[model samples]
Target: MFSGLFLLAGLALLLINYVVVNETVPDGTGIVSEVVSGEAGAPPPEMYDQVVPAPRDSGQFTTKVARTAVETFRTSTMRQLLIASGIALVGAAAIAALLGWLTARRALRPVHTITATARRLGAESLDRRINLDGPQDELKELADTFDGMLDRLAAAFEGQRRFVANASHELRTPLAVQRTLIEVAMADPTASPELLRLGQHLLHTNERSERLIEGLLVLARSDQGLVSQGPVRLDEVVASVLRSTGGMAAEQGVTVVSRLEPRLVFGDQVLLERLVTNLVHNALHHNEPGGSVVVEVGDQPALTVTNTGAVVPADVVPGLFEPFRRLDRSRRAGRDGAGLGLSIVRSVTRAHRGVVSAEPNLGGGLRITVHLPGLHRALSPASAPAETLGV
Candidate 1:
């Protein structure tokens, strides 16, 4: 368009610069003589015009030509043409750009929606649908396919969760019966010391099995994401956990040092309590006599648990969060657990849309931090007065 306009503009301005005209003049019918005074020593007489005879035809004439220039570019016609051409060129370009932008935005709208829905998907939070409505084009097909995949995933996860929950419930009855029979047998009047000891060992094994089943149920639930959420006092939860586990800490010969500063987080209260309990219990269980566990609630992460024990290697920290995984040292020390403590902590943190990380402490053991988003911004737990307590 620009090229054509420029060509037209050039042609419109390139007008005739000159014009020629012809005029008829009467011929010299009669020869008129004019004599110039002669200069000294000049051959002027030979160069002078001599009087001649008259022409016979009076119609004979000489044609005289005159040249004139006609200007057309100085008129408003050229100016209006140039202005119209420029406006057309600019208008065409602007319209093209606007249309291209609108087309791209419209085409990618479904893609954006699909991306957002995928990001929000989880084991239990998979109920979203793209449901894009438009012509049966490629983008619409992609969105429909993604929605179907999510539906299938949600159904599979729901079935798996139901199985675990039901199986755990059913297994509880047999464990109860076994415990009752063992107690009744141990109550026999003529039971020998060896039988009593054997019965006690069986009872302890049964208790551990029950703990394992309970942990599995909790782990499964956490993996499904939070079903309920609210603002709960983090410091209070830690305090209660430390107090409740005080007897375990005593039995293990581990000291609990807590610096609790009230902080609020949004999540299920029961899960939050379990999170703290598991952390504290794991710390105590891994520790030796005279060892200490420090628990803190702070600004950056809502909860922090640091314990003193055998030096945990930096490279080995990541495996601690896997279910049924424990350090070689912890396993050799005869620690009694199903190794689901840190695993459950990780699941709970993920369900709450939070991050949990474990780092090897400088001296020994692990520093586990939970960075949970809160319902409302609270004061820095660092600045708040800490209620240091030993349990």
Candidate 2:
């Protein structure tokens, strides 16, 4: 566009010069002459006419000089004008480009906002919206549409969470009643051997059902989000979990070894404890006899639990965190597990704004790591008393 404008300006200047030159230099049959007398006092010459042939038409010479002057003036003026116009055109183009870039960036500001909001949106954060404030333009309409979708999604997730929580609560009572009835039947002295065996089986089944319900409730609660938070000592939490599971570990003949360091984080203590307990229990339950379980606590990756067990394929480690996911022939034959340990671990970790990962060990068994944000300063191990449990 700039080039076209420059060409037009140059052409206009050339046309004007052509018209001016044509007007200033005329075309006509005219002659210029000067009269000369032989002497002032002398009479007119008698030989021939007194005019001396009119000095050979000096008008043509005068016209030639005039045309030369006009052409020179026109050429100089056109040269300067062309240089100035070229510079001006270049400068105007640069300025326009700069202004256009800035305007485009400003116009797309809402698009950037929408992208960030979309990246942050998730199952837990469906309530977030891109509440853009501006005139009712196309971009504004897009933002409004996105926010409306999030509203619908938030409502749906809320309904699902409520249903799960309610169902778990409703099932608790009947399960408890069944467990009580089975225990009473087993305690009756007149009960036959077959009846007592059936009662024991019923009791076991009821207990398993109760555990499942409890796990579901915990998972749903964690998904809803944190109720309260405070500074929690991760090392202390690990110690507590180890204490709770020491007997089980001993029964399974899995040696528990730990190198715990003082690490402080902000979260619900109960959920944190549950996270540790689940990981530790999973490590102990899936281990070979006389194998070892190692627990490490530090700042970066707040906790790590590695245990010796049968070889686990790399591909199967990811699915283990999904609800009710179990590895083929990985668990002990007679052991009882609800298969929600890793699922609860993941949920609780996410609730605390942390990450959890599992990997297959090169030799055998699995390694699980949990990474959580840490406080700036926390109590040292010496200042905080350490607790130990018999294993």
Candidate 3:
């Protein structure tokens, strides 16, 4: 709007200047010239001859007088108009710029509020929100987005605290049970074979409990810093996992097959190996007798573990990898796993900046895939061979 106004003013000024500068100036030629000499320095020639000119054959003496007056009027009017327009233009431009700046600042006020609110919020103060009451616009949308982010962060922090508490309780329960059993055995020397057997059972329970505790610890470490950035031989890691689980696979009539393509990746070797092992174990445990567990390492550096003959429950598959979320309560019912295998796989893969996905196989089974970054040459685990520490 302002630009249009300025352009119109400029055009008007140009038209006025054109009219003033281009008006023709007259050369005197009139009938009054016959009454006076054509010489200069004569005592003021007749007023008629001075103002008018010698008469021309074309009869243009009166036209000359009109033209002279028009020239004089245009020159006087244009000089005054130019001065006025210059002042007006500078004043209009300054006002326009100031108006634009003010409008921009007003439009951005909500953004400033959002920034201030976010800066004021911390881990302990995420409950606070930028409550803006205005018509729906981009600023309102931005505020809504900020509020959603805060909501998610609050829920996540709450979940973390709950997880820590639950894990601690789970770990302490078996230890407490084992401790009571051991105390009772120590108090009585004159005990039966059944009593000794009971003690043995408690010892086994304690061992299993210890494994769960260690697994939890490993998971926490994986979430923290155990997965380092370095080169690792993925083929070697898979080979190691296969060798370690070979005996377990044989016992369950689960034929272990590997179609590995040698590849290197930038990640912690132990974690990657654990991820594959857990997937393989998940497939084996959930399979029928004589079921095939196929571990395929693709040329694209993806690992796929597929098992035969086990239908996964629809609802259970969604939260299948969540920590402490079990698909089955009793081990005797089906696969008697601690239900931590998939969770651990997810954690380890995430630590190595990789992705893990589960899908139903075409031939009546489950297929799990792990895709991670890879390169040409193999890289080894830094510092130490990652081993499970029994805590």
- For candidate 2, the per-residue lDDT at 191 reads 98
| Tens-place lDDT digits, model 1, residues 40-134 | 23222322222112132421211000000001212244456456656665666566667766877887888999899889777657888889999
Per-prediction backbone clash count: 1, 0, 8
Best by lDDT: 2
How well is each residue in 1-391 modelled by candidate 2, as lDDT tens digits? 5445545666676567656765654332111111112222332243123223324466455444434444555566666766775676567666766776688789999999999999987676787899999999999999999999999888988897879768876899889888888888889999999999899878777877787888888888788777678999899889878977889887888888888888999989999998998898888878888888889888789999999898999989999999988886565423547788899999999988899999999888999999998899847645334333324
Give per-residue CA lDDT, model 3, range 113-149, as digits (tens). Answer: 9999987775445688888879899999999999999
Q: Candidates' TM-scores?
A: 0.73, 0.73, 0.52
Model 1 spans > 4 angstroms off: 1-95, 329-334, 377-391
Q: Rank the candidates by lDDT, best first.
A: 2, 1, 3
Which residue runs does candidate 3 get wrong by more than 4 Å? 1-192, 225-227, 313-315, 333-335, 378-391
- lDDT comparing candidate 1 with the true structure: 0.74
